[model samples]
Target: MINSDEILKKLAIESNIRQEEIPDIDLYMDQVIQLFDSKFMKSLRNEEEKVLTKTMINNYAKGKLFIPIKNKKYSKEHIMLISMIYQLKGALSINDIKAILAPVNERIEKENFDLESFYSTLIELQQKNINNITDQIKIQEHEIEMLENDDQLKQILFISALSNMSNAFRKAAEILVDDLLENNKKKGDK
Candidate 1:
């Protein structure tokens, strides 16, 4: 059986690119790829998994997932947005991500948005939530351990419970995304 402590430690060690880690200057596509690879490689399940490829970056640019780049280079805000898209991709479709980030992109273009402060706040909130998540995991582990089942069965049950929770969260996120898109469309029509 996998220990809860081990799971918590793994969660703690998972990569989260701090605001300070991002370079102040704009980066070329190749440099962006290298940065992502270095920061996210440990989070990948296998060594063969690519973090961000040129094609993916190009597609994101074409798809308007982030603001347009200049001189074939990406800025700090671009990297932050790409990192957000990468995380959201695990639970949301690319279209969903685009819809959700539309307002943020618009703000960046139209207003003097403080993306650095926003990103820093987001990272701090995420770090704070880890304790809450680990607590939930510990509670779930205790519940699973109480059941009189074989070790394999217990593991399966634990995974199934986690999957159900993940599905619920994903559905909620999708609903919120839909609502935001609908509201945006309404505002556009006005």
Candidate 2:
């Protein structure tokens, strides 16, 4: 039997996947390939073209489609799986692909083949991402509030000063007009 490391190295070279990208290559070789080559992966691609790029591989890994083998690195199974996903990207969303790969990843990660328990963790992870997004929104809202309040204060102060200047100008113009009218009347009478 070919060793797991050899399989992973081969997969890396063939699929353009980096060795470092396959997180846990040493411990579980069979499960790694199995997760990658699941029925979902196969259905996603055409049989003739089967290699994937580093981006696809990383997406799959992060999406929970494939668990990194613990110790061994490369294998034909991993290559075939990536090939399948590459084929699928044409029609599938990253989230859709992740959903399809979820069960397979769960099984591999557990090493025991049970899937029921892993769903809980997946939900938790999703919730955590949501919380993080919400927190960022809250911080942005607070910053906007501060900026808006400061702008309003500045506008109020500016308007008050402008109004006072306008009133003074109006009073001065009225007094000047009255003085000119009185002098004209006196000259007419004389």
Candidate 3:
């Protein structure tokens, strides 16, 4: 049997970038790329995978996902926002991410929002979800073990359960993004 404890440990390690790890001063583009590469090295599927590139950063700027850069350097807040974009890109379109982050970006521009504190709260919530997911995995494994001696069926069922859960969460996120966009439109119209 696979080691569930090891999987849980790996998940916890690979899934987070603590707020303190971010550099306090601004970084050049290359430095930003290097930071993400080092932090997310284990999460990469292959050695050749690039975590962040100059083009991607430029494109994100063009998309207005965050405030404009200053003097060819990225601030700590910019790095945090880019990290969020990296996480969301796998499951959401760029438009969807833009829609979701629009209000936050506005606050950062107009109100000097404390992104560090907001990111800390997000990390706490993520840790809670990780614990919940690990518990769910254990339950699923126990149920799989109780089934009849059909290895193929067990594997299929386990994968299906995970896929279903992913689909549900992705759909929920899409729905929320749509609602946010609608509300923003209504406010603009008023």
Candidate 4:
């Protein structure tokens, strides 16, 4: 049976793509796809798992879900945005992800903020409590260990908690993004 720890260990520090990991300059669509594909492969998942695809990247740009590309090349901002969408897509709807990134995209367009700073800060924040997260996971592992006979109950509880956590993050992100969007609009009106 597949265990969370095994899946998570494959993720390790490689899961979060550091700003230094990707090219600082713009990249072609295929380059973007290749990067994502290589990352997915590390989890030992099938190639057909479809983490990111050409059509999806095109669709994201068409939908303006992130900062659009320039001269057919995706900037660092684009990479960060795409990376985030890939991470969040599993837990949130496309529209929800769009809303979450809206403010950042606007700031990028206005030259008010660069994605390098934002992405770096975000990565740092996520890593700050990495140990705590691992501890929590170990606790969950112990709890599941104790309830081995009640596998169904454990699955239900774990999924419930996961869903709640996803919702909490989504709601908090929505508030910040919405506020940022509003402030930008108000500035434009002035």
Best by TM-score: 1
Off-target runs (Cα >4 Å) in candidate 3 are: 1-3, 6-14
Give per-residue CA lDDT, model 2, range 1-190, as digits (tens). 2222432343332322233334453324454444454423433335675333345555676665656633445443344345445534544556555555554655655667543334335435545654554454344444444555566664454445445654675566456545655665687799
Provide the global lDDT of candidate 4 against the true structure.
Answer: 0.76
Candidate closer to the true structure by TM-score (higher is better), 1 or 4: 1
Across 39-98, the per-residue lDDT of candidate 3 in tens digits comes to 777776567978788999999999999888999999989988998898888789999999
What residue pairs clash in candidate 3, if any at all? none
lDDT of 2 at 103: 48
Candidate that scores best on lDDT: 1
Ten-residue stretch with the least lDDT total in model 1? 6-15
lDDT of each: 0.88, 0.48, 0.83, 0.76
After superposition, the stretches of candidate 1 with alpha carbons farther than 4 Å from their true spots are 11-14
Per-residue alpha-carbon lDDT of candidate 1 for residues 28-79, written as tens digits (9 for 90 to 100) = 9999999998887776766788989999999999999999999999999999
Residue 87 of model 4, lDDT score: 73
Point out the worst 10-residue segment of candidate 4 by lDDT.
6-15
Q: Cα RMSDs of all predictions?
A: 1.5, 32.1, 1.9, 3.3
